[model samples]
Target: MNLSGVFYLGWRYLVRNRIKTLLLVAAFSLVWLLPSGLALVVSKIESQLRVRAAGTPLLLGQAGSPLELVFNGLYFTKPGIATFSFGETEAIDESGLATVIPLYARFSVGGGGGGKYRIIGTTLDYFDFRGLELREGRGLIDLGECVVGSKFADANGIGPGDAIISSPETLFDLAGVYPLKMHVVGVLSPSGSPDDQAIFVDLKTTWIIEGLGHGHEDAEKLGNDARLPVSAEDRAAAGETGGEIRLNASVVQFNEVTDENADDFHFHGELSDYPVMAAIVVPTDAKGQAILKGRYGRPGGLQLVAPSEEMDELFATVFSVQDLVLGLLGATGVGTLAIGALVFLLSNRLRRAEFRHLLHLGAAPGAVRALILFEACFVVLSSLVLSVVGLLAIDRFAPVLVRSFFG
Candidate 1:
């Protein structure tokens, strides 16, 4: 019996029953693709999480979940995590054991239907620590100035000289936490990390958004209508018992800082007492890292953690869950293959009359067996090819999908 002739006859039979052939191919392809596709996505997520976590040596934040601190500091996520006083960072810096870079990422710009972008309040040290470079304009030099990430700038079509406004924490902010308009001074180069989606600004700029600091018009320039009544005793303490003190709605609080009024901005409280969501601690040497770790080991108010270790623990749990899911998928795939085999067996049984007629018309028994084998191989091989093509498409798009999701 000619092997090519057997294959050609089998192909013709399959083409005659094209719907069954297509269904079997699709089912078998899914059986192979599901588990493999999931594994690829998990691998991509693990790599993306590990890259930034490994780069950061340590994270300091309010005593809570170590994972939350890691996400907040490294990825600018977990915006609702508790914050520690900026004084804690100052104290850590004074120890001379590590370089402290404070991060205040509680605020965001745009929301509702506009899409929210994280406003990362950090020092110049953060840029250096992350090895970020500017692609346009210059670094932040004044209040309300910002440097946007590459992804954010590109998505919004914003560059130097454009502006971004902070989104209010709530619609009914009774404490007067209004949105602040910030000038975009620069855009960072793409780093393929979470920083690519953040908006970097001075720490004080975040404070201004929180109502901890503000700029206002000079009180003396306000007219009498804007001024509120002042007590005589209060006026006497000011060494001015003569004119009414302007201390009310008459004085306009600036929502945006310009070069002329930048100097007028001031904080309501001590700079050290301001809130920071987390801080990145970079030690000078191994010994310094040990010392800093030991110092914060007995923490009550604050906690020091290794981001890499936290990530390991997180992925450990994720992998355990992934293994369980993959096992389930494997079992399902086996069941699918069994059903496919049953379908082939039944199809052969239904074609028994045809096979018997071929045998009567001078065909050998071995030829009939070969025809069945060819049909089975065709289905299996076609499914395998389709599975491989699907995996390749997923591999190509996984990174972009993961980045967009995380960002």
Candidate 2:
């Protein structure tokens, strides 16, 4: 068989029936990329979620939807679990199972794309716990200061000293309480995790936004311009009765405080009046987590769920459908391959006269056979490459589709 003869014959065999060749390639490409693309997307999302959830030992939250609670506390996506008491938060921290970083993620910031980069009111330890770093600006240093993740900063075109305003937590209904406006003093570097898509503020800042804490009291009404820290002692010294607004906005318009005048400037609220969505807990590992789960998973008590386990279950449920679809696609791809094979086989048989003429002129049977194989392979491979390119384009836009359909 002459190599040159094989090349000549292969080109003729494939290009001769242009329409059939093109259709076969198209079918092959779709068959090749559909399942692979779906698998790639699912795997990517799962891996990202799992990586973020790794250090998390447990999620402690209000007795509500376990999925929502986990999403809020762990991913900072859901509206969030209720705030655990200082006592409850402390016990979990002292649980000796896993070092706990109390997370209170309920407040929203306006101007940040997707609402304040998912504001998380947590302690300084939370940053270290998450392995996040400072890229351009420092971490949260003061109560009013905030550390925005790189993506948050990039999206908002904001940097240090660029303030972020707090919006009411719930946009769905007015039933949710209003969180006060907060500031963004710092921004963080990208951690390549969900943290990269978040904004961080101090626990006190969250308390302030939740109306659990406030800034200053109206001085003229109190008959003193002296700075007053609203500690237990200060409250006692002032002989203040009824209630005091924990936050005193430097930006509050009115200054006077009195029965007649006090209602104008200072905003007042009780600590317990504020609602916190959830807290994150840490147990040692899977076994310790199981033990902890047994304690909280009782019939009518607070629910404790492992996010990874729940996420896995969720992924499994969704993928079961995907698996079925992929199986059908694979079968169809195989069928397409069979049909294409038949087409080429018939084409080869039809070419016998041409082959015989060539053979008479010195073309070998081996060359003819090789020509047939080359044409088939070229069709399959071309299809596969085109399919892959199409799949990548689909992936680029898949998130929007996923949100549109599933969200």
Cα-based RMSD of the predictions, in order?
2.2, 7.7
**Tens digit of per-residue lDDT, candidate 1, span 240-324:** 8576566775466789999999988999768998999999999988999999888888858789999999989999999999999
- Give TM per candidate: 0.94, 0.71
In candidate 1, which residue pairs clash? 226-250
Candidate 2 local lDDT, residue 227: 37
lDDT of 1 at 334: 98
What TM-score number comes out for model 2? 0.71
Worst 10 residues of 2 by lDDT: 249-258
Error of 1 at 291 (Å): 2.0
* Local distance difference test values of all predictions, in order: 0.89, 0.67
Off by over 4 Å in 2: 12-19, 80-87, 94-99, 110-116, 168-182, 210-273, 283-294, 315-319, 345-369, 384-407
Best by lDDT: 1
Error of 2 at 297 (Å): 2.4
CA error at residue 129 for candidate 1, angstroms:
0.7
lDDT of 2 by residue, 265-306 (tens): 323454334445665676667776676778788865467777
